[model samples]
Target: MSYLKFDKTVMINLEESLTREVLRTNRKGAYHCTTVVDCNTRKYHGLLVMPVPAIDDDNHVLLSSMDETVIQHGAEFNLGLHKYQGNNFSPKGHKYIREYSSETVPRTVYRVGGVIFSKEKVFSLYENRIMIKYTLEDAHSATTLRFRPFLAFRSVKSLTQANGNVNQSFEEVTNGIKTCMYPGYPELYMQFNKKVKFVYEPNWYFGIEYPKEQERGYPYQEDLYVPGYFEVPIKKGESIIFSAGDSAVTTTRLKSLYEQEVDARTPRTSFFNCLKNSAQQFYFRPKEDDAYLLAGYPWFKVRARDLFVALPGCTLSIDDPVRFEKIMSTAVPALRAFMSQNSLDPVIRELEHPDVPLWAIWAIQQYAKAVGVEKARELYADFVHEILEYISGQKHPDMKLMDNGLLFANGRDKAITWMNSTINGKPVVSRSGYIVEFNSLWYNALCFYTELVGGAPVEKYDKIIKALDKSFPETFINGYNYLFDSVSGSTVDWSVRPNMIFAVALTYSPLTRMQKRSVLDIVTKELLTPKGLRSLSPKSGGYKPYYVGPQYERDLAYHQGTAWPWLLGAYLEAYLRVFGKGGVPFAERMLISMEEEMSLHCIGTIPELFDGNPPFTGRGAISFAMNVAAILRVVDLLKMYNAE
Candidate 1:
């Protein structure tokens, strides 16, 4: 049995197919993401979601979906499925699906009456284009396929309305038609490989609700414009290619273009390969030689902290040193851009997270190990010293250096850390002052700076290090052996959160051997799960078991108890550090448990987060770049320990 192929039993069931999603992305910030049955369940779901440089930097949903219908003789069978406003389904094409396989590219085989055909989808490697090949396997008579293009032409975060302002005209190109709905937006081209008839009928489909958006408490319903439909004749053993992109393609060269796209992708046959491929999808190179990683798919932008935390695993683990340097180069300019705005923050104020600059130092240290210290320092030393100086000089209300010589972030802005979910202006999971991970990252950053660049900075780092060594162990550790999550004025949050793992996992840990072992033991007993480590221990109060229901409810559980797969990287690193080579088996087993996930949701990619409870159902963003990087990092750790 193929790991990624769903049989008729699962495909025929609309509920089962709708819950699962498939995501195909080009490394250059473009994607085709939707449900397995071609029914969109989220506002972000689209056939051509790409960045329009002329309009804005954010991605937009141009073509929402393309519905295909098979016409034979005088009868027509709709092969496109859609979920309407009142839990009603139209066309219901999933019933005709015999099998859905993502073993290679996303391939679906459909059987209607006496006609048997298959559809394969492939996105372009570096462009905003998607090609769908429809092959008629065995048809009794002439079959004509009709393709209807649904247009959204709006930002992924917003809903589109059928307004009178939209242009309802098309410009004819070679075997294709190009049209633009709004000003400043890129023109969309719908091209066909064979001679086809374009029916110029425009109408509005109203009250299309996205259940995922509704759950997130956002406006989920919108009106989509159907520009027209393309009618193409087909016979048995013949295949036709349909292209949707901003630029028109040469119809005669469609086969070569499809072959090139398929050949460009790295085959995903195993867990490691699947993760490697997933890592590649996150690398977005907008300009020549400048690369940055988007944090997650279907809705996340390029976050500073996420870029540094996920860089080593996404690039280095796969042995792509060139990309590592490319990413580093881009970060320098990003920091420079922030500095230009006269802000001490690592990134812009809106995009700033206090811990991001600290994470950059940790990323530099990891990059140093891959490419020698001399080379790494030669490239990143200035960037590192500048960030450290900026962070040290600033004394913000939210993030400040206290008399205790440890960094403190006032839990006032809980969004400053990774547990950033908020409800009604209040943080769901508050970790305010003297955060564990922030301190650990700060300590490591200082140590790394002292080791790399010795000057006035070294003396300052030495004094802070001495003070942290005394204050950290004295104030944080409880009688239970594990450290407290955070310490405010008089209140000690003794929550068994997974943030403590970083203390032992970083390059320069302030925790001693005994302290590291205790932290690992407690984390293993409480937070560790098959999918990843839970944000909060189930034994703790206000532990959310499920990540469902409405927006506020989901936010309450997002960080309160959601299991984040990205934390597995830190857990695996700490396990190796504490137990040396002996911990290799445990790390291997942990990574192996997620192998079947390759065939599950977001096929071939790791998810953003999972539910805290048993059977840890993958939830949150479908395709997360950091989660894939975390898995790759764990694989690297295991290889190092097992080799010894």
Candidate 2:
């Protein structure tokens, strides 16, 4: 189920616009648990500030029993209240509130005590308190908000709440939120191809915050006296109300405003759906992620899935030839390093994931098909020599393999590659035989190398392929059920993760149809949740449900149990591999639901993961790359396969 809309009690002044807005969490909103936007602006600055003892309260949890909604609204946010008693002046400003630049934009901007928010003809205006009212029509709505500075911008300072009075004088009233975040002058920090960046600074304080999460706020560069603020529980499709003396007027007026305007809009065709779907592909995109993207919002590493999907996934129709080439451009380097490194010693190699997999050879062949055989061979020649050098190293005595070939102990965490950890906090899911995904990638490497350097590479690479073919079979658990992360000496025995989906989802894998079926069945049965695929089975003790919070706990929570919606594309791909290809709209129709739901939040993206239970708790995330990238590729697969 999605999140519930909250009825927030927002505090404002004489000069502020009397407008209201509903708060929403970007990702969780999909599951009906939406977050909210601040009134002063369409978007609010996300800061994890320390609480001032006065305004701070206990953690507030929201639960609508009948609706099956549960939300943890932490009390830490309310601690931002600091009393400003220093400067006193004749409070010239009458009212202060936030309003939007124009009615054309539903997203709002805040105004202070002296702002005027108004609407035009054919629409009723609710300008009683602060000249704030709205009217929506079928096509579009138009409105304007104007802000006037407080009495020549009087020496502003935090004042004590004179009993939380709304009509108190500016200097006497403990009001005015001092946020570096104030659209006060909300400015953009950086402009990237994909995202818009804005950095928040405290007006009075000089502190450098990583601005990461709530717990992550440790005095970094400078320890500015940054005080935190409280959050109100707000809901969707409803208005928030706050008043000191006249409760009846505020309610009666707001209700009248809603009833009067609700009838005017001939037909409201909300674009929430359009907003969700349009952000998926290369629509309106000025620039796409390079074939190799060094990420900021998304995590690190050159993602194989992201790149592969981005090529045909996002851009194939536009620059079909060039973008596809760009996708494979690094395939050569990635393969060469992989083979060389693994070839150094049988025990030394561990593979990540692959785009085309065995089809790397085929993808290369396809590249040749698109460009020419000469270009393909020429590109192959660029990196094949490194394989020989790595082979020399592998043949050496001192060259040892990590974890006897199954896993490699890397970093203090002992993680092997990216998907190297388990819920127990053990870094590598070290196991016997090659991981399904790893073997798939390795096989692709061999096939790709053989395609590049024919004679010697075919023979040499063939021998290694034979070893993998042998080791992989031995690794499969006829005794238990599925494959683990890797195969070497001691294997990580548990976890039927969705990693195998890639092995099947890849253009090709070394496994036979029978082998792929068994693995896919195990994953589908145990790991596949409705939202996506869970990291662990709910039936297992190791299972941890996904939610939000502090990192160390969150990381442990991240992969262990969270049902990642992005990973669902893998399942969609694999399912189509055997069962649905010849069928119409195999993947195309499948994504429409996700596109529809996800577009509700991130202007054009999907969340990192969702709750692994019924009603699918979508929380603590928004606009993750894997989600968008995977959809891109999966949609491409549907389009391409359908064309075929």
TM per candidate comes to 0.93, 0.53
Clashing pairs for predicted structure model 1, backbone only: 411-432
Over 1-644, each residue of candidate 2 has an lDDT whose tens digit, in order, gives: 11211111222331122122221211111011112232111111111111112222111111100000111222111101111123111121211213322122122222322222222111122211111222211111122211111100110112111122122121111111222212122111110111111222212322222222233322222112222211223222223322111012334454454445434322213222222232222221112432432111221223444434333333332225665665455445565555545332121123333222232343454455446656767775544445333432343222222222221222233444344445466653333334456556555556556655543556655766666566555664455556664444454545667776766766546667877788778888888765678877787766678555655556666667788766787788788887766644645555655655432443234556776776665544454545654565566557667777
Best candidate, TM-score-wise?
1
State, as a TM-score between 0 and 1, how close model 1 is to the true structure: 0.93
What value of lDDT does candidate 1 attain over all alpha carbons?
A: 0.85
In candidate 1, how many Å is residue 610 off? 1.6
lDDT of 2 at 302: 34
Which parts of model 2 are misplaced by more than 4 Å? 1-376, 384-413, 420-433, 451-457, 490-492, 580-589
RMSD of each: 2.7, 15.1
Instruction: Give one digit per residue, the lDDT tens place, for model 1 in 456-542.
Output: 457776888888889888878889999888898798898889999999898887889999999999999999988889999999999
